[model samples]
Target: MLSREIINLQVGQAGNQVGESFWQDVLAEHGLDQAGIYHGTDPVQLQRVGVYFAEVNHAGSQSKYVPRSLQIDLEAGVCDRVRSGPMGGLFSPETYLHGESGAGNNWAKGFYTEGAELIDPILEVVRKQAEACDVLQGFQVIHSIGGGTGSGLGCLLLTKMREEFPDRMLATFSILPSPKVSETVVEPYNAMLSVHQLVETSDLTICIDNEALYDISIRALKVNSPNFKDLNGLISKVMCGVSTSLRFPGQLNGDLRKLGMNLIPFPRLHFLMPSYAPISDPKTQSYQGTSVPELVQALFDRRNLLVACDPRNGRYLTAATIFRGNVASREAEVAVRELQTRNSNQFVEWIPDNVSVTLVSVPPVGQKQAAVALSNSTSIQELFLRTHETFAAMYKRRAFLHWYTGEGMDVMEFSEAESNSQDLIAEYQQYQEARAGDEDEYDEEEAPSEGFSQ
Candidate 1:
């Protein structure tokens, strides 16, 4: 299978330098102290992956501009290398940032601009590597979905890659800017739209907020420098956390095709939280609904909220609903119940067996994240009882459904149909021979390969 990681750096902007520092910090966090050493080393095989740097032309005031030096660090030692075939030519689209008109003029500007021609060479290299593999695999593309270059261009590139390599799995790690530093109205909306587009095409999309990461750095590490180095280090650590968790040897490889066999396409739901705050009590607790808002804020404070979603799926959530058990305070329980009832009346509709609901309860950090799935159940007790066996039990139900109804099932059914069709044709030939009184039976020879395999 093809396994690759493609990181798009915002070369011309301050974020580009920040990204470098992020990478360094991540390496340091993982205990890899050598400078530039992390780029060449494979996380799985622990070898050097060839790193290549390319020059991309960023947009200026005029239509044509001088190219800036942006680098793509590829770990070639990894199993799946980017191919050099038809798929490689897919990233040949220009990246442009769109801005709001009139009042938002100051808030809008091009982050990075590049003609389609500039991406051609990079894609060509990817195509060549992909074509040589027997089974095209998984890819992790990292870049910020903020400002111009990373958001606009990165989304376009992801869309093209998805179109070209439909069979292979792809995931994107997007960095979001802090609301305070953002241009407020326009930039946030632009970034959100860009990310939405990328998520629709990708298998899984992971988001890291710059504000959250920065807070962690300042509070936890006491890093005072606001320069690119420190900022980049924080971003890199977040990326590394995700990359390490998903691709670590013991962890299930985060290939969507493989994941599809055991889990539903992660539902697409937008998680809206008020904002970040300082944590007064570092101690963790199982708070009820009355305190859920504070708990969520605290979770955000720790920068530990991990949200995964598939935008292509039709699962839209308009409001938040919290559920608490006996561990929660009485006030918290009452508050949660009231909120759920209110939300149920306003936003939720009770569909029959068609819809599945998942309730994941994250325990105090030292414990595991508890998850329960409910279908057509009125009380939480029934849902919890059904899902109480183990973490795998909760996923198993979803996995079975995904395998039977999702694309995974479709692919298998299609293959079976082709096999049956071939069998029918062969039988028809045999029947015709019998009718014509022919004694010999037909025998088929192995087909020759033209470098491509079915």
Candidate 2:
């Protein structure tokens, strides 16, 4: 069977850096080097890995197939550095798009001018990539909401992707700025626009909080000062676990479509929080094998959650537990049945039992077992609360309004976007309240839950 071809469009410095490490993890998973040259000989397995990348050179050319990743940035230095780096051969040189002047952490600069100027060139590259695929399903974008290029240009790209290829999927791996840290004074302003666009566009948007990531690095990896390289590598591992079902077929939910079907019931409730077990880094800490029950329990712990949240307090609309790497089917069923009894972590009674358990025997690299859970929880309400609070504090005083207005963005758009952010938060809050009030009625009806197929 042919694997689904998905293009990866990494925008800005944060995006490219993250994609570099992401492909590293993917190459390792497929038994390939940093340059993406496959080490295996199995015809079927090789093609499966190839599905995720594009062969840059001709059929017989020296340049091997690289991940179909388009590295875009407002500044040229990062691209130049990557081209001269050890893995330069892994990517097509022509795919890098850049400009002389940077976006300067201003969303207006990126969206109105920089991103707009590069749209034609970026689209050209995307068009060529689309032409190469036998069945081009969609593209995945990676960037942060704190900076101009990553937040502003990233949103512009997503908006265009949605407009041009309305039929194809657009999944965004968005890095959320730390609520406590001051990345830039204008970050609050940038995040408001970026997140609003994410909510308006994109099919599946996974919010990876920088705060949560940093916490994990310090606690799990024992890193004194976790740099981008260290943090990105850890995030890449989670992406690998998330992509396992997409790259390899084993049990149910092996395809990207199923991932959306099983997890996303509503469009706006598309915020997915990923949690991967065995959080320890092998270099800093030992790789320990854990029981199915222990792994499942860890996923429930918010400390291991990719998004910073008190999940025990948040309401879950739907959840999926993906147990990969030699996990037994019976063990998976028993684990879910057990996790369900801990209603302290379970869904409200009124809503259907929406916990899904997908058990696949395929193991991740250098490990015998692993588990990742994608939960569509209301904890994102808390997530948005932080962004909105920061944004509102700035917007009320019209702080940094000129940065956007000067770049052709309407001043009112900020308020509108802030309103949009508040609406999603309110929606999640409402859902949490609905099931509780409707619980008695649901109980009287004796309806079957749309939960675990085990």
Candidate 3:
């Protein structure tokens, strides 16, 4: 049972901060408080701690469940805050990976110097956690692709993890930078470069855009100025939904191995846009008990999506919908039937039937039910559009170019990143356009997108 254990590695300020929120969500779900005290274990919740966490044995009985996660930051402030925060005691001091100075939003600084220096120490902790796993399947890197520490060092670790554990799988949960507000003028640089590494090294990378989260925060939570705390909570819910099948036993297609097969048929096109419903938050209270068909339909709504994607325009290459908490197998099948038979659920010409629905009846920690959709759709092209445009605008003007050059990184790296990102945008665009002006029949020239059954 522990053979497929996942080793999570949370990198950078964005990663650690998000990691904090994620842990908070998991703790709440498991009825564990900030003090690590058990609130209640009514039916006994599904704890992934044994797989992704290690217990620090106390006197004779009580033990602290510390995640295999290694929280890293180029600077001290974020890591320091987590080390002293309310939930700080729940974590081990050794898990906080740090360096002398911040990356100043420069990707090269983290990639070349900082990440290179911390590799040995970080791997040591990872080794200890892996040894506990008995059979370490792979890693889940939680980080933003638009920041220095997350983007540069996150990519560095992705490559390093691949080299260190060649047989294991590497998956990333990446946060896309908001289009409007950004701290780094060179966010486009960081995002594109990391995107290249993610495509190359990782088996699957689930992307959640900040634009969608910010909008959800304002509309769903009704927060005037939502901070990372609020946004991270929303992200954590989606993560929980995606991971429920992994944490708890289900019929099929629940574990990390099957999730990869369901989400990523094509190795390169591994970007999955996650959408979950019904949206739950602090301000929001009741779940009106939506019908199965409505639940299925709502799964396609961009409003419920963790990432901002245009579903109306783009084609779905493949999709996997996970229904948890009291959802029956018959319910899921009927819902998918209604969508396909009664309503329009668009799919690409290559795979007309790409949506694989799975029903897992795991008890929810808070919400009564959740429908999480992991879709490999061409709408992801829209995300690349935002990064590409902003990157082009900033790159053409040579904005913040000196910081990278000063770090001893070659200037041509930027061009390479642009070229790779541009290729991605074009590839998705081709996938989207191929469906148009052509019959549903597969063209020999068109790339064959892999598919699987429910």
Candidate 4:
């Protein structure tokens, strides 16, 4: 197979922070230093580096690898920080784009006013990046859904990308808001509007929430007072895990579209829950030893989920489990099969053999073995429901109507967004109630209660 390329777009403060950690990990894995210079002697490290990097050669200097990524924000503060950070030189200067005045946490300001003004310039930069790829597979956007820049401007860029490169795959590492760690009162409004746009724009949306991140850090990593950096580190691990097959030689190598095809059973139902295995504090690594089966089980545990939802509430439509390290393919396959057989009732019978596994020979930088799973489970509706309730509560009183309407946005867009979000929630509920071999005859009253057949 030809080496495929992926362009990453990081938006807003949260997105750029996660992107920073992501690039740091990616560089370490590919043996590239802080300055993007190759320092390791392993030739295999550079084999599939083109997936996220562009190899540049100067007239008389050795080769340097630059990330094919863009850092965008509605304010200049975040972008400026990244430019002066430790790995600042790793990126091309032109990739950073920002505006003078911040969006002030207003979705309309970012989407209709300030964000719209910068769309054409952002697209031009993206176009140049795409042109440089040998075989561009798709783009991955990293953003949050609870703020102005990430929620509003991020979706704007996604809309334009879909229009400009209709055929390429579009995936996102979307950060959803949680009341536990919210920075603004209108996060529900911002989040719902972003989801409405994501339903139409993105091919795959990997849902994440701060509540879950806090739980994992506190419980697993033993972080007493977890901060954004702690949360971003966990997200960066999953981000790298999801792209492992594309970044390295793997037994079951699948590109962005192929991976999406396997996991996404329906078009609008592309939101997924991600879980990572062998999650432990580095301080306790010496006492921990995990097997393939244990790791797979960990991947399904609700505590390990990056999104705050219980898989037990809804059946699994499909899943892709990517294992990294020296684990044998035969053992990994057996483990997944046994897991499916043991917990057959947890999965949907409509899609037989719904679980797929991939084995990458190289493990993460510090771990002996690791695993990541992306589950298209109906339980994720719980997340949307939470956002809907908050949005409805706030909309009922028209608490922050003036800020949005002042930016030339009509009140109908809010109604449409709310209605669209409700519809999305209903769609998930519809599929959750569906049973195998009974598409048309799915009578809710007669649904099985004991357990679904294998």
Best by lDDT: 4
> Alpha-carbon error at 151 in model 2, in Å?
0.9
lDDT of 3 at 227: 93
TM-scores for all candidates? 0.43, 0.93, 0.91, 0.96
Tell me how many clashing residue pairs each candidate has.
28, 1, 0, 0
Model 2 C-alpha lDDT per residue in residues 188-292, reported as the tens digit of each score: 888888888998788888888888988898888788898989879777878878877777766775566677777787888898998889787677335365898
Q: All models: lDDT?
A: 0.34, 0.80, 0.77, 0.91
lDDT of 1: 0.34
Q: Which ten residues in a row have the lowest lDDT in candidate 4?
A: 445-454
| Pairs of residues at least 3 apart in sequence or in different chains that clash in candidate 3 | none
Q: How high is the lDDT of residue 179 in model 2? A: 68
Candidate order, TM-score descending: 4, 2, 3, 1
- Pairs of residues clashing in candidate 4: none
When summed lDDT is taken over every stretch of 10 residues in candidate 1, the lowest stretch is 445-454
RMSD of 3: 3.3
Per-residue CA lDDT of model 1 for 1-454, tens digit only, reads 2334333333224334444444443334322333222222434323212111122333443111111112331111110111132222212222211222211111112212241323455455456545544444555555655454455455555667777887666655556655544543334433543544653676654455556555555554466544445555445434443333232333123333433222222232111221122222223223323244443224222243222111111111221222212223343334334433433322122211122111222121122221111111111111112112221233334333232232122334323423333343343233222311133332212211111000
Better of 3 and 4 by lDDT: 4
